[model samples]
Target chain A: MFNNPVTSLAHVKTGRLRALAVTTAKRASSLPDVPTAAESGLAGFDVGFWLGALAPAGTPRPIIDRLNAEMVKAVQMSEVLERLGALGVEPIGSTPESFARTIDAEATRWAKVIKDAGVKAD
Target chain B: MTSLRRMRCANDRLGGARVALVAAALFAANVAAQQAYPSRAIKIVVPFAAGGPSDVMARTLAQRLNVAFGQPVVVENRTGAAGAIGAEYAAKSAPDGYTLLLAQVGDTISMSLVPNLPYNFQKDFAPISLVGQTAFILVTHPSVPANNLRELIALAKSKPGALTFGSSGAGAASHLAGELLKGMAGVDILHVPYKGRRLPPLIC
Candidate 1:
């Protein structure tokens, strides 16, 4: 199974790649017409995909700040936003502090999911 | 001479006020250091193989960074260990602003799936920004008899190990999601991981 709608939707948007449900609780902005996983009967299955830019732990705070500011600017660009939207990507551009908190929370969340699923690296 | 007098006056300030002055000076120096830091090429290491989601994202940002910084921003793919090798390399690299990392959710999943990892994400990396998000989509070949999630579960139950699935690789998010589906659905489907696709769940 392709892990994201971008590839799946790209492969065959109409025939084979019908998006039955998205993992988000709400409908995906890119695929607003499609129903959510919960709406499709898989209630509470809200797994999501997120990406971040990170520097080494001791990287200068100013550099991190500059990077974050530029990224925020990039995501807000109309062309970038349009491309990302079409690819089923949501531009977050959140603060470094919040991004750190998100990583912490997500690490914990996926750990539980993998643990409960007894998922082992084959 | 005037600056020296101002420094003396700042030193004369008491307790919290003096501490604030010292902190302000440190912050200015830090900013100055960072401003002049990335005069050379900056590397954004993609832990996954080239052409993957992370790599594409990294490349996009690299282009933007090149324009923003007026320095060539390069994307280096340090693939392997399901992204841990690259992540560890990035973590251990000099804390200088020259090197950055484009970390994906797969890397986070690896934190749980891979034990005794060389780098602790929280400890080793400082997040700059959440670039974007992508959702995992579960798909089946049209030839498969099952049409929907419920039917798929019923079919897998009747067939047991007859259902086989594929993933990008072992320890990849899709593989884990397959395991999760099996556990949640309670059926005996086989998992076949590859740099390919197709995953099965014995849906019960």
Candidate 2:
């Protein structure tokens, strides 16, 4: 019915991207890099998450460690990973150590951008 | 003797006053504590916005639960960043079970999509029964003139960078699905994003 909202289909249902790709492959092999007039006219969009925990400076490390450990285990189960992949998603399954590093890097990246652009969240 | 009688009268009044004050204070404290967990009305925090499947499910569930709990279990919409606002509110609530959250599969997706959410779905929330899951049909715009996936692929390949598709937004399942299609089919379907539900027959 050409019924799906472009944004929800594009962003929220990202997991189904893999299956969609398989289907689209049978229809057309090559497509455009930018939205067509018709595509833009539709209402569908999404944004990815880059932020995480923001506890007070002195929160215990043990708590973070335990949570991250559980998260890794939950994300790594074969059923979970397969389900995520089938949804066109790849998991990081990172440890607190790695997650900390990514968090630091993200902070640095965003800090620089904020400094350069003078961006502030209201 | 007259002074003594006056002092006794004053003492009786003072004692009566003190007793009344203490009793009033205790009553107030008990009432404050008993502010009825479900007080006036309760809100079930549905992570998604109103009108979506999750929202609908939550509202319907809230209605049924309200019937059982004998309180107005209102469905509050706190949509943003893919249910983060709703989840965070539920996590920070008084663990009294009055402020409930309706979580779905996207709970996991948000962990990856928005890595730094304030709350953890598994930790912050007590395990509630799993809701339901919905399977979607992979339909395309009829204007594409592709009868099947094969024809669609050929048309896309022949006119690479010429065709486009719509997605809810970046990192959304629909968006990722489009990206996956681009990556796997080796086609470059341009993605157009929006900020609403992707299902058909929307109420504009």
Candidate 3:
């Protein structure tokens, strides 16, 4: 079964489920002992479930900037950091430009994967 | 007759001036409303069901945003159609900084798989800061013999169509992750997709 660390970490920790590997480029901080898929002999096997913020396209730039500033600050807060960290989630408070770039890159990367694998919407 | 024509022209000019004044006043009011952002509740649309990871993350951010802006920041779950419903709702909403979508990687993937989606992911949304990322762990029931990814791949290769992996749903991140693993490992393991948030225990 493939599940995010938030829901599956406890089962993995308690020995109920045997974690084969994390499907991310970096090893999870909470499960440092577990090897990443790439390290486990599948090179370039990076698949992370990333979350980001977005508003409608016509939203003013100033408002977007304000939201970004507050979000970046909030994610870095000690309480937020600790809460996310325990679930093996990495806090990334990136600028809007960088986030847009990530979205573009991910869209391209996953589109090819879906096409190659013949994945259809259900 | 000339005086009557002059009087009509004067009335037309007066009407135009009144129209301009009202337009200016409305524009000013709109600007004032925008400047005082979050004058009312700000909603974050989570495309998934409540108590899911996306919802949890949105609520976490909402709490902080509420405190920072001194206005209510709410998380609205608009779940359905593998997150398309909420995404479309957010996309068509007024771009006044009050409506936002807690977007996930699934949304980007849906662009390729789901055809004729109402809004384009890149064109309809403005990117904001990335919140956080969680790694998906591939786990198996304790009874499986494979201890690592390599062993599991070998096991699947040996018993090609016999082993099956379960996912949260069709076209979900988990399902795609399973597909990626299949493509990378060059194995023929079957994919079993479960519906909704409840995932049955791994049977393979």
- Model 2: CA > 4 A from native: A1-122, B1-42, B69-71, B184-186, B196-204
- Evaluated against the true structure, the overall lDDT of model 1 is 0.77
Worst-scoring 10-residue span by lDDT in model 1 chain B: B195-204
**Model 2 whole-model lDDT (C-alpha atoms):** 0.48
**Interface RMSD for candidate number 2?**
11.9
Separate DockQ for every predicted complex: 0.51, 0.05, 0.70
Two-way TM-score contest, 1 vs 2, winner: 1
Cα lDDT for residue A54, candidate 2 = 21
Docking class of 3: medium
Tell me, per candidate, how large a share of the native contacts it keeps. Answer: 0.74, 0.02, 0.89
What would the per-residue lDDT of candidate 3 be over residues A30-64, giving only the tens digit for each residue? 78898999999999988889999999998988889
Higher-TM-score candidate among 2 and 3?
3
Best-fitting candidate, scored by lDDT? 3
Candidate 1 per-residue lDDT, tens place, B94-115, comes to 9888889999878789888888
The candidate, 1 or 2, that scores higher on DockQ is 1
Q: Write candidate 3's Cα lDDT for B1-204 as tens digits.
A: 999999999999999999999999988977787789878999999999887768878988999999999999999999988899999999999999999999999988999989999999989999998888988899998899999989999999899889988988778888889888899889987888888668645737
TM-score of each: 0.78, 0.46, 0.85
After superposition, the stretches of candidate 1 with alpha carbons farther than 4 Å from their true spots are A10-14, A82-88, B1-29, B35-37, B142-164, B181-190, B197-204
